[model samples]
Target: MSTNTPTPGGPSLPQERRLVTAIPGPKSQELQARKTAAVASGVGTTLPVYITAAGGGVLVDVDGNSLIDLGSGIAVTTVGNSAPRVVQAVQDQVAAFTHTCFMVTPYAGYVEVAEALNRLTPGDHEKRTALFNSGAEAVENAVKIARTHTKKTGVVVFDHAYHGRTNLTMAMTAKSMPYKSGFGPFASDVYRAPLSYPFRDDQLDGATAAARAIDVIEKQVGADNLAALVIEPIQGEGGFIVPAAGFLPALQDWCTANNVVFIADEVQTGFARTGAMFAVDHDQVVPDIIVTAKGIAGGLPLSAVTGRTEMMDSAHVGGLGGTYGGNPLACAAALAVLETIEADGLVDRAAKIGSLMTSRLHALQERDSRLGDVRGRGAMIAVELVKAGTTEPDADLTKQVAAAAHQAGVVVLTCGTYGNVLRFLPPLSISDELLEDACNVLDDVFAATK
Candidate 1:
């Protein structure tokens, strides 16, 4: 429909996958050595291939290996890396004074970005938006706003949820090995409840799952003490787990009845990544507050907390905002991203991408019982690995398959509480041919491993 396929590599890099050498060629290995010396140990890389250019569906690495980009930088470059409009906007904004600090001298870019968010997010009710630097910051601020509005302290998150790395979000997150390991004494009053994981929950229906979760909340943390119930409409880092139908609406209804703020953490699922503009659109569930990041500003570092006007305003003046919260460059990039999504009809593109991926993964699942489940919406899809003839997780196999894909010049990522899900967040800019090639590679990898 819309012809906005981004040429991030300036028309020089080919979109097709081309492997000049091994996966981590000599040049990339050299960069890795330098990175080991310069960067912190906590910072890790998945592919370890230093990217020199990326555009369309391929990432050109240092050794001229043009690998197919299936991860989209963990769903950050949904509009494609170095998208035309985003690049132009950032270039123009940087030249025209980068930062005046919104807290000091406000700029129109910040206001415009907020307006776009307020209008674009799920819900027609009067809303306001506050920008931040990362998903964790937005989530933390969402809690702050909810607490101020509801006058409550308790925050509820779902099992297998991955909020962020900040101390507060770490407590909210479910996994511990890497996200929360050694990060002790997490924030207080954060509670975890059950989620509607259909594959692992014995094919539990949505209503029953919601009831199960509601019982936990009511019995453990009473409604009166709860400030907000934060959830990812489609859980991200915890696996691309799509909750059973009616699950989200049920939670929203319960939150409404309890006077608790319903916050949708759309950090990894927003901006057309999940086919719909936002994942909540699937169920028509309107959250009291929605936290967005990832694809909001193409590839720039920007996050936002948008919600009802009253609740957003409840926070006292000077309560919100940071030094580099709504930097002009980020805001400008966000504006371009919003425009690109609208003008280029990316919502439909994401849906088509989802259909292609789902079909391919489902076909693979039929041949291999190890692919326990294939689920997700739009470009955000995943296949959970399990032992044959049983749903027991096979995290080891997941690592093998992902490593194999990486070595073959396909950038695949693994996730899940058990670390057995191979999640795919390919950029919509990817052509059907590239998508098919990636799927074929997976097929070969699975067969070879078997």
Candidate 2:
């Protein structure tokens, strides 16, 4: 809960930061040894092995490696890890009591979070909110609400989108290797459409790109048969793609005309990750159901489906929610996160990160032929690695660049259909100095690779 910056007399050497033993450091290696002996191999992991503590943009690994966390624990720390207000709220809530599942005994924290979601989520129309344990659950509930409201079964998603890892969400998701490899026969009636990938598709303009994708649904899926069209306003794991300007409004229009419930999966882009409270706000487009997670509760596990009141009310009284949907600790953290974002101007901070990243990455592209594209909205940005002067993907190069950055004390993540994009999500509270340092590390990796 203390300020992320070191106290008056902070350690000269980062505590639990990058130092001492190898990357996995001696202590981390021992922990890893124990983990391998005890944990399941199926559960995947990213670099730097382990973390002992985290605050602001830095992660202190078990081996004392202090890493600039660009991934934000897969986009969960947008308000920064251990934010003071969030920490205080969490501690205070924990001291009072932990859980009395809303289903059993209703609580104020749950109602407060729902009220906040109702107030913040897009749509001037009346809306309602329902909480869940994970983004997947929120998504599932959204679909259920859609189907229940419209009395239809079909839901539309996009290729290269990463929804979640659950059965139904696996069906909603487009990736295969890790999420949907052996997970299906997944939930049925989920359809996939083409995304407006400006770097990859040259035949159409942004408007045409949106129309082309809509045409497929019109002719193949048939709007009459669809209950919802769910999309990421700014695709997250799907290469951090930000659709062209007209793309979102077109989709929303199509959804409006067809009476299809348009759902914006802002799991990664919500809560100022995209510089706006919700990425859909970028286009001034509102959806029928807006699902949120990741940074919604700071580092806590909490997600929600915030949608128009009528549509949300379509489901019967007992159709939604879970045992841990609005756990008090997570609710307290969510409230604090909202307060922190407003008080600290994190939305603007997200916007500034976007401008900085675009400038830096654009410069990198100008000099390196292997850098094919620099894209994304707000702080959720990425650089696509390609074979020099070609559209051909270079996942290998992506791995090397990210690995090198990790070795250099910065953390980065790779995502895309081809796994060739390096995505960034440094905490909004990170200092300009720390940000420049991380950017310099990226620049060094680029120079080395080029």
Candidate 3:
């Protein structure tokens, strides 16, 4: 008896969209002033604003300004804020009692979530799941699991990887200023290799690039000492860089040959965010382990490491877990997120978003020399800015465009190892109308900046 579609009666979409004042209006200004007074400036922010309410594709700022949320809480709210099913599930879990600690008193929510993760991640074989509170925890635990399973001490990362901010992951991450600077002396023995960035390294083919990376890893750390080769199918925070077509397959092959654990850190690119349940599916490369968080539990904090049961079990009894890991509320929210991703065809929607954004950014790049390269898979798209007539990065111009977009009632995030790429991670559920409006705003800002 329900006649709902993605248009109006859609159960998970915005009932209405409204924007009265400028973004981060009066109330946000006051709160932001207070935040600066209390919070550390070292923790930099891309948008100096506060959000109050959100649903579907719109974010309501504390100042009551309704801005189209292209960021999706940095890709955590793919099911969209206040999704009916998700909200209902969370309410139900809250009413049933929030937490009892899985280790102390194991519960159904935790087991069910582990079951869901096992069923959803790559590989049809048996899998085991371990939950955590954030992506950082998941990555650290994956490394721990990999090292335990392989009995190796060295872990290999790539040039533009952005794993997380924990000290160990800070060692895993490649950025210098915010994520890594002065955060060292970090955990030792993590090594970095060259990523297959074709736009920048046009001299090599995908297989050649993979070989180059292996050369560095084999030469610097030695395969005898390697534990895991972790990578993002499409790089997130660092920049939405999708490596060349065969890159993933080649790297995965190398991992198998070297007896190294292949870890796909899909925390930002998973759960239908990149047109697939997991971005690793694109290249038909099944990683030994897939680390996921972000969009997994709707908006709640939950992450998992699902992989070959043997590897996951390599850790001794009681070797992995946390106090708040897989909290009941978060597990309920995650169950809803999995259902929404399937029920709403958001995976296909991710492809649709990628099509729309790639076309628009490419057009902009054609028109503006500053918009140098447009790359990404599915909805995880980015436009790299450069000094016109050269590949030299233009981080300053990227900063300006982001600021102008925010002032013009749109919020866009900038990222890249060099901080010169404008990345877009809008909800897969965002409407075409709202999406285009955001695109038009970007056009205006780009024109002005030029």
Better of 1 and 2 by TM-score: 1
- Clash pairs for candidate 3: none
Question: In terms of lDDT, which candidate is strongest?
Answer: 1
Error of 3 at 413 (Å): 0.4
Candidate 3 residue 227 Cα shift, in angstroms, is: 0.8
lDDT of each: 0.92, 0.85, 0.87
Residue range 1-450, candidate 1, lDDT tens digits: 112334432333566777789889999999999999999989999989999898788899989998989999999999888888889999999999999899999999999999988888888899999999999999999999999999999999999999999999999999998999998999999999999999989889899999999999999999999999999999999999999999999999999999999999999999999889999999999999999998998888899999999999999999999999999999999999888888888899999999999999999999999999999999999999999989899999999999999988889999999999999999877888788888999999999996
- Stronger candidate by lDDT (1 vs 3): 1
Q: Report the C-alpha lDDT of model 2 over 239-338, residue by residue, as the tens digit.
A: 9888888898999998988889999998999999988988999999989999999999988999999999889999987788788898999999999999
Off by over 4 Å in 3: 1-19
Judged by TM-score, which candidate is best? Answer: 1
TM-score of each: 0.97, 0.95, 0.96
Evaluated against the true structure, the overall lDDT of model 2 is: 0.85
Which model is ahead, 2 or 3, in terms of lDDT?
Answer: 3
1-450 per-residue lDDT for model 3 (tens digits) = 111226421244342345567666788889889989999988667777788677766777777666777888899988777777788999999999999999899889899999998988888999999999999999999999999999998999999999999999999998888788876799998999999998899746888999899899989999999999999989997788888888889999999998999999999999998888899899998999999999998789999999999999999989999999999999999998898888888888899989998898888888998888898888888999999989999999999999988877676899998999998988876777777878888988999896
lDDT-based ranking: 1, 3, 2
**Which runs of model 1 end up more than 4 angstroms from their true locations?**
1-12
Ranking by TM-score: 1, 3, 2
